[model samples]
Target: MSAVGANTSPAIGQVHVLADSEKELPVPKRQRLGIAVVSELDSLKASSATKRDRKRQSRKQKQLEKLPEPCSSDDVLWKDIVSVLGGEAIDAAIEDGKDVQAPLVLQEEVELEVKILGSNGDGIAVPVDSKQPWAVVVPLTLPGERVRARIYRHARLHSFGDLVEVVEPSSSLRDMSRVQCKYFGSCGGCQYQMLSYESQLEFKREVVVKAYQNYCTAILEENMPEILATAPSPLQYGYRTKLTPHFDGPSKSVRKGSRKPTTEQPDWLQIGFNRIGTRKVLDIEECPIATSVINAQIAPMRESIIQNSHTYNKGVSLLLRDSLDTSVDESVDRLSDAFNKHICVTEPKSTVREKIGEWVFEYNAGSFFQNNNSVLPPLTDYVRNAIFPPSSTAPSTLTHLVDTYCGAGLFAIVLSPHFEKVAGIELSQDSIRYATHNAKLNHISEDKISFRAGNAGEIFAVVQDFPRDNTAVLIDPPRKGCDEFFIKQLLEFGPKTVVYVSCNVHTQARDVARIVEEGRYRLESVKGFDLFPQTAHVESVAVLRRVD
Candidate 1:
């Protein structure tokens, strides 16, 4: 009993340890002392972390600072991304806790991505997920390129964006050449200068088709006819017959803190179009699209205005109209009238007569001639064919013709021979005066060709008393389309045939719908002419026959 008690007591002098993976190794005496020091310092400043922790957080902040700022909260990037990949895919991707950056890149890398479809001066349209449901319209983009973009604005249900990169270049881009003018992209005067002429035609055709389809709910029976059918420009460069230039007083901010005399200073002036996407003036000395004659005269015109600034405090605007006959005497007379009377010289020089069917008409350069001189014969022929088909069985009744919105009696004087008498109604006194002169020049009896100055909408009141049998009306309204009053008047007059000519299809379609619904006019034939090549603008002629 004494031995056993001694052994048990002896065990207290030695330590026995059991192995445990969860337990940490014991620290040395020096390490323990250092930990004790750290704990004491942390307790002294109990609210803040240690210096090591602060250093780690600083490193993280620096890393974040290197990344780009996120787009505005209202941006459409997220919406577009979600749209491209269905909502289920988007939700699943987020739940997977994968890197957010991966989704953006994945969305952009789609095999067949939506692209910018087309552009006018205002904006561009991009195909979204739907074939035609939604379009992403970005300003300043050429069509047919797949682009990675950053959407920064949202409108109604669509979105707007800035092009980041062209993921795939368009065939049109490959053929595109450097713009003829340096200021083309910024001047807002020309939108398709960068595209090849062929590409420009395609672009314009698409614009017409889309506009008619989207805005009018009318189906374009065929893709827009070939660009050649629209009439290519004979002289692509220096073709503009009219030019207007503006001047603003000197920019005082630029002259600040200068000792130069204000009288000798040059004031800021603008002679071209407003800046792209803005009304602010961009000073232009010469315009590439204007004729050389016009450009050559601009400098002197500007100088004259500058010299007379004190005498004429009012700002100045310049207009130069082209005449078909380039006789110096004629040009001088036209210019003198424009300068002295502030009248727009419609005819620059007297040109030979334009013959349509049996009718003939003369025009001056200052007067309005369809800018596409090459296409007018064909276009007018088309109109004539549409109105009076060639057949031996045609009705013998005297076909009376009324030309509303007639300028210089283009349609009226040209088609007068086919009718017993043709009447032309115009708003501009100058135009009416020229129309009268035009009739005299062509040797048409004044009684046969009557020119009246009045509003197109009120024209029916002036011509209502005339016979209506075998009667047809030809109207080429302004880009704003005909007014409701005019449409209503047309309905009441109820001519057998109505030929509606328009430069803007959207407004034209609206008017056409009204005429068809209320006037009982059936759309028989509609055709578009590409008068302004290298631009989205197109001229459309629609024939509507009264429904019996």
Candidate 2:
């Protein structure tokens, strides 16, 4: 059936509210109480550009040009905020045959064929008939899948919905099997478990390439390196070494910000993970993505929580870390058995051992380490080999290596053998402490590898000591990626080689664009690692060399 001709209705930009009884899925109380203010959009005007738009653009550019150079993007944190500013939605009791004027009215069900997947892994379907500008985004539906969905939200650009069911599955679903975990759809932990392992790798690669082409196409026009083939994961499932399951007490009628404790008992302890898009928690039994040892602790952990659920009047987050593998070595296994038991029983305060390749790393259980231990060796080796290319006929001219945002010193410690001296800088003292211990654990000399708790604002302050022409800087920033200040500082420091690692490719592409735009660095190569299998997340590493 053609989706366009079925029950044709007038375009509406208003928000719609559904009664609690009409909601198919149990929405969190917070979402049910949300006030949506949608803007009225003229479909024809929106589709076609106007002369006033050019004038407005010219005015905006003039204003921006007047702004001071080196403006404080450091203080500015980029975020996308959508707000609804008008009236309540259509009545909850609207007749079934009656035409609704609300575009994203709750309980408004539609059958859509998904055309593509959005960055957050949602299936986007633009209506073939609608003169309206917005598309319907349905979660848990793949590209080319015909799905039934109920609209719940109206953002500026698109409408969001929850998938009711797949009416007709995509061809890709032929390769996909049933999701292993029972809580796969509800839990936000994994997004692509339904997709086959090989397909997941390809999807991740497409995500990286699309992000760059969409956000940083101008930079690519200058010098776009072919994004290399995605490195496959050694283990698809049972790869994660850590899991943080949390619990929050049942909702209360107490006044907000009141310090007084409520005498009324909670209905039940809501534990496990936050529901896919809501603050509501779904009690979890097992996570297939986590290591077998970590999954084994779920029963005992739940038992403990049940026993103390009454005491937990507030929210609590429990950390489970399978830091050590017993199958690594005989002697080390015996020594780490006590440590592993201690980690499982109590909160890890001291260092925990994690076996990666030949080295046993000592890092705090809570510290930042590679999430997927199975793919960490290959990821690290790729970075190490990229630093010194075999194709280069000249010997290594790089004397010093500086690693910024060196959490637990993974890159610094592993790549120490390639450089004369490596200086690792971190903002967190706790991470630096573990990093130092990890270096010692790996038998790296103190003189050769040094960890420092340095200021992020002054990240390149230490690079002054090393010759810019002979130094290489490695940065593996958090998911938000580096700000303009850091990128500006990096450009000023002007190292010989820069290896940028990031989990979020959009931000990585943005930062890399600035580096190449400055005409100092040329993009050498880009490679993605499937560190997070069964999910949309991909770890990407980009290599850039100083233009001679």
Candidate 3:
């Protein structure tokens, strides 16, 4: 043999012993390895790649776990949703779609008669005049309408379809005359813009009804009161105080090196909500659902974003909040005219002000406050009146109110006058700070109202001494609703009454079902508030009384 070992092929997993390369010595070679491959012979440096991949995969898994989950999934549709839409009809339709005789190919077009509008505002349809096992969920359709739909996705129980044509229109439910937004079907921001406002409210009531039916135990439903009519917003089109317009960088599919983008493509920043059933954003010139001030600012905001597109690396939501600049005129008379002075605040950390009747609230624009300022007065009034109904307040022993998740003390401050003592607990230090400030701003004293910071478990522990028989708990949790640990703790505390306010009725129903289980509490009533009019979103309030 030559003076040195001379095998030429070297791969990531293969060990190589080498001498310095020279034409006379040996040829040096490196062979590519399969992706994510592992071998005992893999070099230390080569193993680093596998380690990186594992770590990156773990990070992605954690991120996915943190994402919000919808009420329905591919495996099973919610029973109440199925019942409300088309129970046996849907089942039959699904079977027909999967039938060997009439196979549902991808992008297959079929005329379907929509049976009912789903809680999400999509139309549920079955084959026209066919006793078949197949159903197609189509958007921009109404009940009793014959619509031409193209099957795009076939799920386990049902299929999803794109609305191609309305073969026969619904005279009652389909009211396109009232549509405010051009992006009604395309944008995910709204679902009921085409329907009458009254119809939207009615649909919301149906949502609550179905939510309870699907999410709650029969015992809870038996105790549940007639779900009150969904309260409507005063300004349906221009009520939203906050609008987050999102924009993304250019699509990766565009060939960057091939052509000048200015000549071939649209501007890079595609700003708006996600297109319905898609992750892509649509460019929007005006959002009619947002407040007047935000709409007026949209032109300038879009221009600024376009001008600084180079600064953004990925998609981001730009907050455009409608807030009153009370500082411009601090006079008592000016407070009443605050709405006329609405200004659009773009910065998230910037403080914003809104007045609900006589009470004023100031919080960071980034904070989670009610989006519709018009609905707060009636909503708060309903809650305050709900805690101790007029007939029960005088003889009631409930003198203490515990406001959980009390961001900026919205409910606590609003109900403080009715209670002898009130305490607000929040997880965010910033929210707690705002709550304390808001109490002072609203002229509530420390002895009457207080704010605490920590998790729900910690807050309940600190308030353990409060008499369960004399206190009422008001919980306004995030859309995901309360966790099991928190619910268990809440049951242990056993307050006299519990009022739950949630933006997500589905999750609220699930949580309240647990609270009212085992005959421990009676669900007094459930009501819905149209906090987001012209959209499918509804805020639900469920009142519970101890019965154990």
Alpha-carbon runs more than 4 Å astray in model 3 = 1-77, 84-102, 129-131, 252-265, 326-340
* Comparison by TM-score, 2 against 3, better one: 3
Give a tens-digit lDDT track for model 1, residues 492-546: 8888889988877656766776787543667776666767654556687777788
lDDT of 1 at 540: 76
How high is the lDDT of residue 304 in model 2?
74
Compared with the true structure, all predictions reach lDDT values of 0.59, 0.71, 0.78
Residue 351 alpha-carbon offset, candidate 3, angstroms: 1.3
For residue 189, what is the lDDT in candidate 3? 87
Q: Using lDDT, give the best candidate's number.
A: 3
Q: Could you tally the backbone clashes for each prediction?
A: 8, 4, 9
TM-scores of the models, in the given order?
0.64, 0.76, 0.81
Runs in model 1 lying further than 4 Å from the true structure: 1-136, 147-154, 158-167, 218-235, 251-267, 302-315, 324-374, 390-398, 427-430, 454-458
For 48-69, candidate 2 gives per-residue lDDT tens digits of: 4676788886675464324322
- Ten consecutive residues with minimal summed lDDT in candidate 1? 67-76
